[model samples]
Target: MLGAGAVLGLLAACSGGGSGAAPRPTSSGDGEIIVASGLDVTGSDGVRQQLIHAWNLTAEGRKHPARLLELPGGADEQRSQLLGALQSGSSQYDVVNLDGTWIPEFAEAGLITPLDPQVKADPDVIPSVAATARWKGHTYALPFNSDVGLLYYRPDYLKAAGFDPDSYPAAGMKWSGLQTMIRQLDTVHAEGALPGYQRGWTSQLAAYEGLTVNTIEAFASAGVHLTDPDGHYTADPAQLKTGLDELRDRAGSEYTLRGALSSYEAQSLSDFTAGRTAFLRHWPYAYRLLPQSLGAGQWAVAPLPGDAVLGGQDLAVSAASPRAAYALELAKFLTDPKSESCLLQAGFAATRDSAYRTPPPACPYVSPPAGSSPSASPSASSGETSTMPRDGQNRPLYASGTLRTALTSAVQRPRTPYYGAFTQALQSVVHGWLADPDPPDTDQVARRLDTALRRALAGR
Candidate 1:
């Protein structure tokens, strides 16, 4: 993955060359519409692939077959590839699956076309998630799925530390209360009650977008918004200092797993699953993946302490596509209400309100085995048997209650045409402070960060 500074430089160069008008649409000889996206985290032949297969069976789909071309790498790599392809007209992507943070950049650059007003006004779309599809007051995409950080913990570990697992209120937990639990767990570890217990918690703190995300969550929890809704820099040195203090406490050596300093999502998850930490801060997808490793009663998930960050991808029609109308139809079909419900059952966080509140009809693509109950063990696509508990509706037991609440209240990262530059500057400064053995005074670091952000937002 590209480091923050390198990504910033690339974005600066791209923005310096002003964005021209979109290319005129032309008819294509071939009938295929290409959809470019990051790897489906649900594993090979995931729900996303299955959805495309379902679309192919429709009359409209049969005429214009939609093909998914997955970009291989982390989020930053995928962003770079999309930017290069769209800007240079090198690849003919009819539809693009974009991360929420990239919407403003893509929209303002004229790389994507605006969608109909109905997409923005759709009552079934979650309000917070729908907001991500718009840039400068115009809807440029439709949300395919939503994501939010959640706290996953080993109930067995909590019980070993002399805490009542049933009485623990993870949903309403605060930072102070979490610290208290960490102290107790530390003591228990010294007594050899918990083997391989390195620390209280683990999270993604590597010097990439993960570092930017972790920093934003800490700032949000401290009641700080670094940038205004218009994408202007808003924080002063004092506000930055306050937020930095909270982050320092959370990442302190005595409380956090040491590996977190260089850990990304995969590493942190591996550490947690290997019993290196009692608590883990991860995305909603972890709920499905964990069942493959941990048994039913071994773990549970709840909203993260304080604010969680919103993460997901939205589907946009390429402005230069020859088949723009058909691309739009395919995007809508993949994000419709039934599709959203199937996504929820397959472990991706569904973006529609109805997907959580109403009992859905049978998913059109997959069916349960004969004589199987509604709450069957297998997921909608993956053939493996899932140990994760489900409710009567066949949704994850915590889906309607715990997961829905988190998505409703999750905070978004800064929205800007220069988000690549913004996140790069953030990760550079924050990671430097966190990695230093003897860091500088909080106020000094805050001023440094404030200066960096101001220049970044100005397209410097």
Candidate 2:
């Protein structure tokens, strides 16, 4: 696995460069509230903290200056701690930055307060992202930063394999057609046609949220969802079965990353950016790290053959917050138009449509001049990331406008209050056959998944 530390300087440059120092912690004085998230604020998560510092210097009116409350880095740990606090109706924290998928879970439990009149969806915000901020018709959170999965491929390998770099992103192809492409590419990779290219494609398949994310995307492309808009379980066994078979096949490609069974986005990206794989399925953040790792034009992002799964975070006010009104103001400060621009410049895919209207000044990736160090001491603040590196000067359609369009067409993961349970059930069902040599019994697997989802949603 690539140590995340190896890429901090690159991530820093993508955000228009940052000082290596973590922001000195501020005292939580009378008028200041705390923004608690699973971010280090001084390390990989530095970008957001710097933004907070910038916001503090100008804060006035109902908005109180905010401080950072460091939380455990593990996503689950943060969720657990926040839930415990909310369940106890404590207001030690005011604003909570949550994974987009958690909005339903937190809001339904009354753990997070809705934005209400303080903030609401706007025409400038991406519709899909805006939708994630609302639950039961209330705007429960504000989209802070956003993400969608993308297909990163090497044109050199594709051209060597006799595939046209021109005829891609191949967004028109469904997963079935993508499977054929993968097989052909797999054959080419095994022949050593592209030096150091050891795999056809690599994606997140570990037994964690990433697996569920990939599963939902597969099901969406297959035209089945775990539930309908009303939140009822409505998975189609036949489609799900077919989708599982495809995942099994993608996982079986011989050239697939050898470390795949244990890999997540970081490992997968390290392989691709390191020139070990022909393709990688990862979020936009990879763009910021690639330029530092690869030579110019070495890699590019394209729309996945299927609907990309949306990934990102949102901000919600804690219901128990004594400073709910001011916290709401703080949320606005962090997500407002100006802040959104700062996020984009820093490499976070901002949620507002306006941010994308004018392309960000920096390309997602910029190779620093030769001999420039690839790292800097990053503040532990937060990393709001984006994809698409400027090749020192230009961005192709795939890296810029095309991606914003894809976000409009992207598929969201299931919007259920029991998202945690649903994701676990999904991980179990899919990973069971991911490494199996023999073809899976699709019917049996589908039955198991359906039951798992049912039990999960039913609180089993």
Candidate number with greatest TM-score: 1
Each candidate's lDDT (Cα)? 0.82, 0.68
Span of 10 residues, lowest total lDDT, candidate 1: 13-22
State the lDDT of candidate 2 residue by residue for 233-317, as single tens digits: 8766776787776566566765367777668777888888777777788877676667657765577777887778998889888
Give lDDT: candidate 2, residue 139: 87
TM-score of every prediction relative to native: 0.91, 0.83
Task: Kindly list the per-residue Cα lDDT of model 1 for residues 1-460, writing each as its tens digit.
Answer: 2234533332232112112232233534357889999988776667787677666656667788889999999999999999999998644899999999999999989899887553546888888899889887898998999999999998898898888877664557888888899899999999988888999999999999888888899999999998877788899999999999999999989899997989999999999999899999999888877877887657888789998899999999888787877787778888887778778876789999998998864543333333365644444346565555667776777899989999999999999989999999999999999999999999999999999999998789
lDDT of 1: 0.82
| Clash number for each model | 0, 18
Q: Give the candidate number with the greatest lDDT.
A: 1
For model 1 the TM-score comes to 0.91
- Candidate 2: list runs displaced more than 4 Å: 1-31, 40-45, 59-63, 190-192, 359-388, 391-399, 437-440
